[model samples]
Target: MKSVLQIGKKILLVLMIIAVIIAGTRSIGMGMNIRTPKNGINVSFYVDINGSNQWINIYGKDIDNPVLLYLHGGPGSATSPIDYSFTRKWSDVYTVVTWDQRNVGKSFDKKNAADKITKDIMLADGKAMTEYIMKYMGKKKITLLGHSWGSMFGANLVLEYPQYYDAFIGTGQCVDIAENEERLYEEAKKWTEGDEEGKVLLSKWSPDKCDDTQALLARSEIMNRYGYGMMKDGRDYNIVATILFNPNYLVKDYISYVKNIETSMEPYMDFFAHGLYECSLLGKYDYKVPYYNINGDMDYQTNYEMACEYFEKVNAPDKKMYVMKGGTHGLLESRSEEFSGYVHDIAKRMASMK
Candidate 1:
């Protein structure tokens, strides 16, 4: 019996070793397959902003294609690494540029640098970055695409400097954030109506009492738990798979991605709670350039109803609203091909106007 037990233990250890090797090999293999556009423009470099370095990745099937500067969500989150899975296809028709905003993702620095990370500072950085890209590509203007928190930033930028952009595209657009939060809070309560555990968890805070960032975060946590914020189907996109396999991001970048969230959350939370509410541009609907609001029908995070209402009221040179059939906050990732196609068509229309 002792001999048999020893043999079984040896077999189990060998299997464990094999599993580790397989996982390692798969990770390396995926990294090796990281792809860039073939016969297209692909540029990855650091740009100086306020004496600090921030990363930008530009990819396109042809350098002559319309420039699309994508501002990712998560005031702290960087979407460049994961963008490879979906936005890469847009390179065929648009020069897709993904930037790591100040003090986030590849741009995060321990020193905190020349300027504090604030809405105005970020807007200035964005404007500077847009000018740089325009000069580099020899284009007078580029299209601006913003997602989630990015929408807020992009809205302000386009409104402030409409001459620099041909069009403004917003997905998961934020409109009157405080109002959206209230709606989200009510939605969360409604979802947890009969569930004892959900009720207990949600009972900790109310929207009326959620004045600070921590309380807002607590409310968001509960909402997300019931598929109100992120995954409506109770299954999150294996974002880990994208992060782990993305070749553009090294092991250090992955670590920074997480650390930056914590770093950015403190300063950015107030903006979400009060600043956005006080200074929201939802009512300022007149825009100089073409405006497009592309959103998921099921997106509760930003409140689809609010986006539509804003879209209807917003007057621009040209404007349109598209509701992604059954998408959620992750509409871009969930419906990449369709969304890209829509943008491509919009680009063509914008070119005709030019």
Candidate 2:
């Protein structure tokens, strides 16, 4: 009887150990398997920026044709392994370069990042990445497409280094920091009032309680539940989930190309808390660049009005604003036939100028 009991205990211990190993592997395996499109051109990516060696994923065929060096949103959101989303279709027209900025994605080893992140370090990184892309591809000029946080960086990049880009496209353009905060607060208010779960969650979103990461994440989840409603069919969470996580990001790419919110999970969360708040990347507005501002009127994140205000006020040699009707921030749908056409039209105009 004693031997049998001991044997049973030992077996149970083995099972528990096996379970833990599986759980541990799964936890670290999220982005480990993600791959760049096999057929796409892969650049010999390297950059010495902010004391970190950054990696680059150069997609598409035509390096000579105006490359759209896509700066992704997260002060840290990466571009590689997920290049399929933002650079599709444009790939045929332009050699799209997706840069995984320092401290994000597979770019610069995290060990290089110090105790605090600064806008200077971030901007220096962007400048270095841009210089590297131009030198690597041997392209004298390229277009800059900045999405969300990417847009913020795009604005600053062009302001500081207008000589590099032939044109600039700002999607989900965040020109005002206070406005974004208000937009988020309002969204939170609406969700709390209408969404029962949101109300339950936000009730606990007090600063004191949300001081920690876990509490803050719970608050963000509640906000996303309400925010995702901006999608057309409404309950496309599975499709949305796939948009963010699936390995084959062809559809995800299309979705991101059209709609702008399908961000990788970690960057999305970190940027929201630290980058958005700490990065002094907005509110100045007064700038000059060949700028085309695109916004989905239904975009709640940056709010269409704020983008328009920048277009109205900012001094630019060539400035145009296109408001996609019925389009939310992530307005990449075939249904937005006019919107897609407009993009092609703008590209043609720029190409013609080139």
Candidate 3:
């Protein structure tokens, strides 16, 4: 009887150990691993602005060619890893500068407050960072490529300081405030009503009282899944999301860094989310920059049609619209080959005049 009891305890301990190992492995695997581009030089720096320091990345082949300072979406999104995947291809031709805006990623911020992380603060930090990058690289001008929320900031930068950028390219651009919210609401509604699964899933979305918090949780169901259908071929989002969530080489490092960031300063993440959720109302400004708007055929996040309409009215001498056949904003990394090709063409065309 004593021997049997001992044997049972040993088996239980072994099972418990196995369960812990499995759980630990899964927890480590959950973070996204975004890859940096190849052959390009990765540059990092801290820019001091109003007693605060911000971090920026520059993906350039060499100091001789033109450079595009790439502004990432998510006022707080870190573009260092994913921007490298596609921009490195353009490095042979032009330099690409990617940065984590104030209170984001590697930028310094002991406390994250939404009020302090306003668009004005971001633009100010971006301008300071841009000036620092230009001075550091010994370059006069750079092309500006802003994705989603980045476009919002880029727009303000160009309008306020048009002479700073040589040319501008906006991906997943957000132009009108009211229209975008309506589009998102409608998309969610359609997704919820279209399928029984979607209906059951989004049953929590009370259109009348759904705030940003409610919308955030429900976003995965409507945007993540329905995004698959809106893609040019229905599989683009899947491929991109997969890569963002589970990258081969860059995933582990990126996640480790992200975990450090989150653990060290959780308020930063909260501030970022708050800014993204509430900053849509700041989109009523007029633009005065020469720009190109790039849209994926299947992107429903901000509605391609609305973007097209705004581009048509944009007041710039050198502006056009470029569409990816079956791409989404997330494709910037997942579809690196195609994305690199697009950047190459744009760089070549811009370089021709120089």
Candidate 4:
């Protein structure tokens, strides 16, 4: 019996050691792999943008391909870590780029960023970043694909600096954040009907909770539970699980990705309270370049009905809106491969024009 016990302990210790090694390998992204094709580019590094060290990831099959920059959602939601899911195949057609916006994700710096996240500063950052990308890649103009909060930024950026862009693409478009929240609150209350326990959770939401991330996330959680969340089909979208397979993200990047959502967005609370209500772009987007929007009808985050209504009023040389059936807020992450094809089709046409 004593001899058998000793052998069991030795086996358990070896298994634990092996497990730790495997996990560490995955954490540093060594378990995953990326093969950059001939003449292709796949690299990530820090770049100077607007007096700050902003991080960018660039990948494509051919450097000569048209530049396509993807701006993530969230005033603080950085998507660069998990961007490989949709962008792995994009290099064949586009020189895809993803930037961790200033004071967000890998670009976050507590010492330099003290309440500097504002409309004016972000626009300046966008302009400088656009110039940097154009110069670095030797391109005259590039295309923009903005999602959610990014759509708002992209709209303002192109409208202000039309010379730097060849075309614009928007998904999970942010037309009116104030209107979106109100619509969500009302519908959320309706979902609590005839159910006392549900009402308990619904009571946590109010107009006052708009600037509170924990409260807002709680309300959003309720919305997601009732099928109006990230994905329309009620499939759980787990970024934590998804990140394990992506080679682009180091463990530190993953930590930054999660922590920075709250840290980077803190400065925006005041803007949300004071400036968001009157900030609807219903009729303001008379873009100088061709524009396209890919939206999901089931998206309550941006309010699908309002987006379509606003889309009807947009003016540009070329504009089209493709509404996804039974889609949710994150069409890019949820239906990555299928909908990314939609993006490729749009990008290819724009490249041909250039």
Candidate lDDT (C-alpha), each: 0.78, 0.63, 0.63, 0.79
Compare the candidates by TM-score and give the number of the best one.
4
Q: Across residues 66-154, which tens digit of lDDT does each residue of candidate 3 receive?
A: 77888877645665544544655667877777676666566635544233556566667768777777787787766788887787677
Clash number for each model? 0, 8, 3, 1
* Residue runs of model 1 more than 4 Å from their true location after superposition: 1-38, 113-115, 208-218, 224-226, 233-241
Model 4 stretches astray by more than 4 angstroms: 1-12, 15-17, 20-34, 232-242, 255-262, 275-279, 351-354
Ranking by TM-score: 4, 1, 3, 2
Candidate 4: worst-modelled 10 consecutive residues by lDDT:
232-241
RMSD for each of the candidates = 3.6, 8.3, 6.5, 3.1
> What's the C-alpha lDDT at position 44 in model 4?
79
Let me know the TM-score candidate 3 reaches against the reference structure.
0.73
Q: Provide the clash count, candidate 2.
A: 8
Mind giving the per-residue lDDT tens digits that candidate 2 earns over 254-350? 4443343233244435445555555444555545557887788767666677788677877767778877875665554323345446567678877
TM-score comparison, 1 vs 3, better candidate: 1
State the lDDT of candidate 4 residue by residue for 264-295, as single tens digits: 76766766665554446766858899889898
